[model samples]
Target: MARVLIVDDDKNIREFIRLVLEEEGYATVESTDGRDALRKIKEHPCDIAVVDVMMPYMDGISLTKEIRDIYNIPIIILTARGQIEDKELAYTAGTDDYLVKPFEAKELIFRIKALLRRYGTGEEEAPVRLGNVLLYQQNYSIKIGSKTVKLPLKEFELLYLLGKNPERVFTREQLIEDIWGLDFEGDNRTVDVHIKRLRERFRQLSVPARIHTVRGVGYSLEVDE
Candidate 1:
């Protein structure tokens, strides 16, 4: 049973969520607010966090960024406000999902389950081989010849996605949405930065696999045939 951390200033809301999650067989820890949620995670190490948007001392967006810096768990931001701006801010802060308040308990459970499944599947993704290099999806590592190398999560995902498709061109916006989540409000330069980093790494390795710029469009991965 995965443990879920519920963070909200509203006691009734926390209790309600706790009950719903427990009914679904998820063990839960409760926090009164964002600051408290941080402490709870350190003490109990939850698999995912369900965080309220507005709170005293620390808000969910700030907490989401802090959590992302420290942990790799999925986060769902809950807010009574349904403004598109709020949704954008939540995703920009690194939350994996969002739920506007007044949500059905069943929908929350479904979203939580879906996020869990997505995270779990990352470890089972098959390794991709490109020419003389191999990208190990299971562990975010790469093998070039006999040496194993590690990659930042985004870089590896971008590499894996392109490697799997070979010559398919992926536009910057497509890459951003796919890798950073559809709600990501950041500039397309985010994708360019990761692509630049990946190119630098491959160049250093002297690999035959290359990530090509599609000029006026996007990028693609290519290897010697």
Candidate 2:
């Protein structure tokens, strides 16, 4: 199932969209504003975002630009404004589609499916950077300067999650949930073993980023410089 982030200030609207998305078999996450949406996306990756234009603190246009800067996910603007000027602004912010409020639920679903097809959710995003180490999402590989090497599934997932949100300390519990899933029956020490393996491998490869233990906390991926 493709995960979607819904960003809207109106409670009714957000709930309505959530219902529609969930009924269609797409998993949904909600945020009241762009700031919350940003934080949510960092914690849980989403395939696309449905962003409302008029929001507190950060508007949809601004949020769209920010998302474009960091993520390769598609963005759809949901707004009450039907003005061509507003539509243009949304496009300029890198939104893939725009839908005005009072739209038919079926139309919204169709547009979403079209965009997903065009972008192909199965495709892995562009390589993400952590210091000089380039983490490739598609092939479970990492590049250090001119050298590239494939990583084991668990190791790549662990490293990718940390690298995607640099400096954010992930406790052992969060690591297991995010990378290993709720059904994980192993001890938290599993995380430590993976971290040690990552450190050793990066050292051997001279990768510019390393996973750093956070004392009482868990760990984080940081640039070596």
Candidate 3:
């Protein structure tokens, strides 16, 4: 059974999610505030998280950013706001999916299952290997050749997506939409900077694969042969 964390200021919403998740055979933990949610996550590692976009003390976006900094757990952002800008912001903060307010419980459950599947959390495997890099995706750590490099949330996620698809191209827009959440307000340059940093880390350790730039398109990882 997957363990899930529910973070939302609204009592009813949290309870609703908890009940639905429990029905799906998932164990759940709840927090009504972002600060408390962060603490709870540390004390109890969860397979996934469902967070509200707005909250007192630390807002969902900030919490998502902070959590991504330390963990690779999948996250779904639940919000009343349905603007494109809001979705963009959530994406920039590293949310895997965005759910608008007044959403159906069944839809939420479906999204969670899809994300879990995409992340491969249902598998009972060891580290995932890409060329000379061994990615401990569940833990958000990477082993490049002889050196183990700890990645911040954003970088780890960026690399993970590219590594998962190998040579498939991902446009900046696609990346921002998929990984950052739906409400990200960042520019395309942000993607470039992160990629540059990722490349540098791989280069420093002489990793066998490179994150290749597909000019006029997006980026991808290519195993050098």
Candidate 4:
């Protein structure tokens, strides 16, 4: 499991982010401020760091610069500031990504996965096998028995994420961020539409894996036994 360092002065926010990351299988370390966060990172390096802006001892932008100067770890700034100038400052400070306050839990997870993949640090996701069907990550193609079929980009990535985790359930909100992105203005029904199309395509190809909906919750990929 990847380790994530969470830096925030607000205990509730820290805990909330921690819960979200922990639920997604990431180990978390928490700090109350940027000064403390720096010390923690030096003592226990993490794969990624989620820093909050407007903290006491040291602000997130300053911390981001310090971290960049010494470590190659990816950084994501979580703040209530949505101003363009604030975002520009974060990018200038070497932040890999930024998330505004009141963000979706799924969006956070999606960004972390994206950053890991972008930096080539999270390559542990394996190809999915379901009876006669195979979901290839590298080529972004699906194989059904002897035939190889290429799916649309979003569909392929969505299917791969679900298939890679097998029985793990993913909420519609999670799907939206993982596929449409956090900036997407669409509703959750968009996920349903994609899943419907994915199912239809799988049916046409006679693929054995099916996406199962968890009522009022999310969806999961189920492989036939």
Please give the RMSD to the true structure for each candidate, in Å. Answer: 8.7, 15.4, 9.4, 4.6
Off by over 4 Å in 2: 122-225
Candidates, ranked, lDDT:
4, 1, 2, 3
Q: Estimate, for each residue in 32-129, the C-alpha lDDT of model 1 and write its tens digit.
A: 88888899899998888899999999999999999999998899999999888999999999999999888878768867866776677312545788
Question: Whose TM-score is greatest here?
Answer: 4
What 10-residue stretch in candidate 4 is worst by lDDT?
118-127
Tell me model 3's lDDT, rounded to 2 decimals: 0.85
- Candidate No. with top lDDT: 4
- Candidate 4 backbone collisions, by pair: none
- Sorted by TM-score (best first), the order is 4, 3, 1, 2
Q: Which has the better lDDT: candidate 2, or candidate 4?
A: 4
Instruction: Kindly report which residue stretches of model 1 are placed more than 4 angstroms away from their true locations once superposed.
Output: 121-225
lDDT of 1: 0.87
Task: Write the residue-wise lDDT of candidate 3 on 8-80 in tens digits.
Answer: 9999898889999988888999998889998998899988999998899999999999888989989999899
lDDT of 2: 0.87
Which ranges of candidate 4 are over 4 A from the true structure?
136-155, 161-178, 186-225
Q: For candidate 4, write residues 1-225 as lDDT tens digits.
A: 789999999999999999998888898999999899989988888999999989997999999999999989899999898999999999999999999999989888988987877676765556688787888765678887678988887888898888888899999988887788879898999889889999998788877889999999999998878
Question: Which has the higher lDDT value, candidate number 1 or candidate number 4?
Answer: 4
